[model samples]
Target: MESDSAYRSRVRSWLDDNLSGRFAHLRGLGGPGREHEAFGERIEWERHLAAAGFTCVGWPPEHGGQGATLQQQVIFYEEYARAGAPATVSHMGQELLGPTLIEFGTPAQQKRFLPGIKNVTELWCQGYSEPGAGSDLASVATTAVRDGDEWVITGQKVWTSLAHVADWCFVIARTEPGSKRHRGLSYLLVPMKQPGVEVRPIKQLTGTSEFNEVFFDGARTAADCIVGEPGEGWRVAMGTLAFERGIATLGKQIGFRRELDAVIGEAKATGAYDDAAVRSAIARACVRLDVMRAYALRSLGNADAGTAAASKLLWSNWHRDLGDLAMMVRGASGLTVGEGYDLDDWQRLYLFTRADTIYGGSNEVQRNVIAERVLQLPREVRQ
Candidate 1:
């Protein structure tokens, strides 16, 4: 058996070697608020990664994956981030849905779906958030009624990242009539290219349209596409959300590290480092980043009752503050953009991380989760 150290070294070598040549240009290209950069090139780069069997390193061996250990998985994410590899286009497929299916989907579903995810043959988008139910996922109103051999779906999902480019969407919909909240829900893998589906791009503050509003009007998939039992979609969806904050985010922390390094350097270059206040802020950011990484590594497999909310709260608040600091360091200059509404990287970072505390799990929701689930104070009674 290869030691974790040996595997880590091997991963580093592969990244150093492969991220050269044609792929060299892709490093540091795509990420948050800048998903529109080098779209085709990044897709190809991810395909190259898939060919090398490095895509789903954490999946079990039975599932055509490397079956990497928890430590190795963490190492892979960290090294991959350190290499400045662009954010993966297949992340939703490879990270969230794939693991969810492996745990809850039928053998036939896994056999049919997992390969496309690994090989990047078919891209995926998450259809969880709707205009009516973003953080309150249990209140989803999407409907998937049985129609002979297929489930006809109808609903609108908002803030769907990359739905405009996805081949499939694993959706949570009301399966049984008269059921509300978490009941009567089912997880269905609906095809995105059907006649009933409409994807409209939503332009964000970053001057990029990485998110979309997807309308599903009678969109259909095989009735067998349901993951887990009907009305048990809530459980499956929650499980998938658990994986959403997994090792992949560890790599994201590395990106955060680079951004901090850049901000520190920017502070120095702009002579903001000379200010005692700026120096104090930069030092504080450095300390918080180290704390974030340590907490992330320790909580990779964290199954503590309400600690998930704590983890989300910790990082999101820190990132939002980092963005604020980036803008603060730039002073009035950060408020302006280049020609054609084009934002500089820091400008985009500042603008985009505005939602760092809102998306995934909103800061409000995280606090509620901690208050209700962990502290047992009292769940906010949703009207």
Candidate 2:
């Protein structure tokens, strides 16, 4: 096995060489209002990463990966974020579904799905949150009933990101109707190209349809499509959520901090730095960014040691604060979009940050986990 520093050096060198020329144009491919072309570019970029054996760095070599260590995978993400590489189009598949499959999927299941996912040949969307089940995913009412060899699925999922473009959906449905909220659920990998599955864009306040509401009426999948054992979907879903809260969010912290620095530079150029109050706010933002970075590193250390959870709460809180500070620094200009004073990114980010608190197991619930699991505090009683 190679040393961690050696692996980092190797990945960094590969990115510097392969991503220096035309690849540089791939940066920011999926920013606001450019989803279609950006999606196509991202697919091409994933092909490049797959060809270089960097698409799923930590996955086993037999599964279209280089069989790198977890640290090596982290190095790839950190270096790519620094290089400002285009965002992956298969984020839902690679980050959440792929890991869940690795944990609970059968050998056949892995062999069938891993390659397409790693190569971004079949994009995926998550079907967890519904109109009624937003943060309370356990309340998902989507039903999947056995009908011979096929399971008929019906219901609607709201706030499904990228469903309109996805070729597959990792759907969590209530398989046993009479069971309690968290039980009787089964996760199914449903193909999105089939009939009876409809995706309607849900425009955000930023005027982007990055998310959608998906309706499934008599949608069907083979029984083999179930992930893990029946009624174990909740556990599998939790594992995916843990990955989302742990590694996925950590990968973006450094990039967000870098953006914060750019915001500071913009403020200085605009003479906002001369104001004592603005200077104080920027200084406070810098401190928070540093804290977020430290928490991210600490989370990585815990992941290496196989003990990671407390960092989720820290990250959730700090991310909200960082966005608030950015909006404050941008001031009145933050309200507008599209280029004027670089406010487009700031405004879009501000709107998107509103969802940050809600997704990946809401910050309120994360705090409860931290209090009970990390701090061993008494739980609050509900009247």
Candidate 3:
């Protein structure tokens, strides 16, 4: 095995060499509020990453990945983020859906989907959130029914990131009639470009449309598209959610570190660092970031819904607060957009992080998960 330092050096060298010329513009684009920065260019940049064997570093080698060790994966992500690489366009497909497919999908399903993901030939979007179901995921109302060789689906999904650009969507649908809550759900892989599917961009406070409202009216997927058993989709869906909190979070922290450094610089330049309270808030952010890293690293093993919930809760609050601090350090200027809707990075961060606590798992839902699962407390009695 290569030494971790050497591996990180190799990744740095690769990025330094490749992220120039035509791709220089993509260096810091397509992250959380900035997904609209460069549309076509980032897709090409993703394919460029895939061509250089930099895409799926953690999956087993048999499934078109490097089969990297956990430490190696962590190192790669750290180096990638440290290099200021753009937020990945293929993150959902490579990190979440691809791994879930390998774990629960049939050999044929893996063969059909994994290669496309590995090469960035086919992009993916998640279909787990719906109009009536967000964090209460078990309350999925999207319905799919048998149609000989295919499952015809009809439902409305909101807050679906990149649904307009994705080629396929892995969906959680009600497969059995009247089976309430967590039961009767199946995880199905549905195509997104078909006639029955309609995608409308939902503008966010950042004045971007990274999230979409996707409507499936008689949308279809093969009968064999189900990841696990027909009615066991909740299990499969939850597994994919766990993957969301996996090794990539280590890299995410590296981005957080960069943002922190920038904020510290702002404090120093604006004389906010002279204020005792601002200094203390900066110190607190440093400590919380370290704690987040420790939690994420320890979370690599034994990832269940409870563990995933904890990780999400920890990072969500920290990041959202960091955004709040960004505004505080910048004083009054951070509130205004530059010339119409063009926002500076701090302005974008401030607006975007407002939804951070609400998107992945709402603060209320995260609290509920932690209360019921990790703490083993009494469940909330619903009226």
Candidate 4:
């Protein structure tokens, strides 16, 4: 086993050597609301990372990954973020779906999908959120019915991140009629680029469309594409959620740290550091971020639902608050955009973080999960 320092050194060295030349300009180009920046170039850069065996480092060696230990995976992500490597275009596949497939997918399914993810040959999007189902995934209304060897799907998935560019979608749809809430759902791997599917971009406050509304009039996939037994998808879907909030979060925190540092730099540049309140806010952001780091490191690999929910609450509020501070630092100047409505990093950061508490899981929902599941309090009433 490589020592942690050695692993970190190796990752840093690799990033230093590779993230130059044509890719030199791409550092810190894509993330959050800025997904429109140099996107095609970022895809090329990701393929370069993939070709060098740096992608999907956590999966076992059998699954086309380096089979890196959890600590090493953290080191890689930290180094990657620290290096300002562009935000990956294949996160849905490399981070969420790949691990889910490894855990619950059939051997055949793993064989069919893992390589594409590792190599960045195929991009994926999550089809779990719907017009009505966002965080309440159990209320998914999209339906899939078996037709001979194929499953015909019909429904709409809204706020689907990267759906316009995805070649496949891991969907949670109502597979059994009369099924309610969490029961009778199936996790199906459906392909995009078919006549049955239409992707319409939903404009965001950032003036970008990183997510989309996908209409599945009659999309079809092989019946064998289901991840688990029919009507047992709730379990498999939860497994994917577990993966969704895993070791990769530490890397995300590293990105948060970078964003925070940028905000601090902006404060100094704009003379906001002169204000006692602004200085205190900045200090509080730094201290809270450190606390978040400590909590994440402590909770690594634990997967307690309460801990996960708490972590989400901490980071989401912190990021949104950072956005608020960014605008505060700029004062009235942050309100205006360039002639083309182009926003600088600070403005973009401020606008984008407004949704931080809303997406993934809302702050309200996280509090509810903590109240009922963590505190063992009475559950909130629902209609």
Candidate 5:
């Protein structure tokens, strides 16, 4: 195996060379709340990355990846961020669902799904959250029943990121009648373009519609689409969640540093840097970012539930706080937008990070995981 430095060099060289010409315009485009920017163009750029073997760097080579070591994967993300490459459109497929499928999926299932994900031919959205079951995933109320060779699905999923453009969704639905909570649930792969599936965009504060509410009315998929046994969906879904909080987040830390530097630059220009409070906040943000990086590095490949939960709490809160700091740097002007409600990048960051602590897994949920699972405290009472 090549050294980590050699891998980093290779990744940096590729991104620097490729993110030019027609794709040059996409530098720094698309992210958390900005997924709507250059929607079609970003997908094309991601395909370029996939062709270059940049996407899914950590997966084994036989699965259409570089089989990159965890360190090399971290290096890839760091270089990708440093090059100002646009955020990937295939994260749900490449990061979360692909890993889950590799772990729990049958050979036939892997063959059917992995190639599309690797080539960016089929984008995927997660159908785990609903209006009632955002973080408490065990309470997913969607239902899928076997009919002939297919499972008919009927339910609604809310806050599904990028469902508007996704070709598929990995859904958690109850497959057994009279079953409650985590029991009798199954992880099924469902197609999004079917007549039975409807995607309605949900506009966010950033005025982008990346999140969607999807309705499944008799949507159908082959019975072989299930990842694990029918009653074991909860376990499979948990594996996806663990992968969701994996090392890919290191790239986000670099983005945070960029945002912080921009805020500091704004502070200097606006004379806000002279204020002791603003200066102190800048210092704290810098220190917290370093700490988060270290913590993320330490927790890499450690899938312990408590560790993942704590990692989420650490980065989400720090990012949400960074948003607050950006607002502080902007002072009064931050409150207003242009005539067409055009927001500057700082303004968008402030508005978007508001949901950081709430989405994925909320702060409360992370605390519960730490408290009950790690500390062995009594589990929170659920009605």
Candidate 6:
């Protein structure tokens, strides 16, 4: 086996060669249609990553990974960001469900699903948020009833990112109706191509159907489809959410820093850097960007040590700060869409950042977690 440094260098060299030329056509600011095409191309690019053994670098070699160390995984991501590779399409799977399955899945489940997910052959969407649930995932109203060899599922999941193109969903449903809210939940792997599953696009402020409303009416999965124990869905879901909020956030922060660098370069070229106020603003943005990067690195370290909570208080705050600063720097141009002389990418990012506080648990909820769990503060009283 190659040494870790040798492995990382080899992977870095390969990515530098393979991904550098493919993203030139995708460089400009984009509207919804362009975003769609970019995502499709990204999916193809993820397949190439899988073929090159970079997609699941931390997984064992038997599962189509390179069996790399956690440090190697970090190095790969850093190098990929440095190389300006197009974003991968298997994030929801690779970051969320794949880790969950590896931890909670049976050997048979692992054998059946891991390879497909690793290669992007089966795209997966998260089905935790619903019209009523939102940040309170424990309140999800989706129902799944066991029927001998099958489970009959019915519910509506909103804010399902990429549900239209997803091949499967890791759905959270109420399996025990009258039990405690979190206690009765069960996680099911529901196939989207089944007869009773419907995916309706939800157009965003950017006029893109990047997310969707997924409805499951009498949809069925095998009884064995329950990940982990039947009533243990809450724990499994929390595990997945931890990955969502931690390692995935690290990946995003690294990528966003590149954009922040570009914004700084643009400000300098336009002479905005000379204005005292603009200079101060840019400095503040850079400071917050650095903080975000540091927090992400800390979270990755915690994740590798297996101690990350379902969410972190500092992570959300820094993320919001970074987004707000980028938009503020872009000024009026931040409100426009599509390719323009101005920072239209900043505008798109600004719009999307509104959801950051809400998704992965609202910032309010995260603050509460920190106060009660981390600082040992008194819990707030509410009716």
Badly placed stretches (over 4 Å) of model 5 are none
* lDDT ranking, best first: 5, 4, 3, 1, 2, 6
Question: What Cα-based lDDT does every candidate model obtain?
Answer: 0.89, 0.77, 0.90, 0.90, 0.92, 0.75
TM-score for each model: 0.98, 0.90, 0.97, 0.98, 0.99, 0.89
User: What ranges in model 4 sit over 4 Å off?
Assistant: none
lDDT of 4 by residue, 28-124 (tens): 8888787888989999999999888899999998898988988998899889988989999999999899999998999999999999999999999
Regions of model 6 farther than 4 Å from truth: 20-35, 301-316, 333-343
Candidate whose lDDT is highest = 5
Candidate 5 lDDT by residue in tens digits, 73-175: 8999889999999989999999999999889999899999999999999999999899999989888899999999999999999999999899999999999
Tens-digit lDDT string for candidate 3 (108-174):
9999999999998898999988878988898899999999999999999999999989999999999
Report clash pairs, candidate 6: none
TM-score of 2: 0.90
Q: List clash counts for every candidate, in order.
A: 0, 0, 0, 0, 0, 0
| Model 1 per-residue lDDT tens digits across residues 213-329 | 999988889989999998999999888888887777778888888999999999899988898988898889989888888888878788553667777887888888888889878
Q: With candidate 1 superimposed using the best TM-score fit, by how many Å does residue 13's alpha carbon deviate from the native?
A: 0.5
**Candidate 2 residue lDDT tens string, 173-220:** 999978867999999999999998999998776667878999999999
Off by over 4 Å in 2: 31-37, 301-310, 336-343, 375-383
**By the lDDT metric, which is better: model 2 or model 5?**
5
Model 3 misplaced regions, further than 4 Å = none
Q: Specify the poorest-scoring 10-residue window by lDDT in model 1.
A: 303-312
Which has the better lDDT: candidate 1, or candidate 5?
5
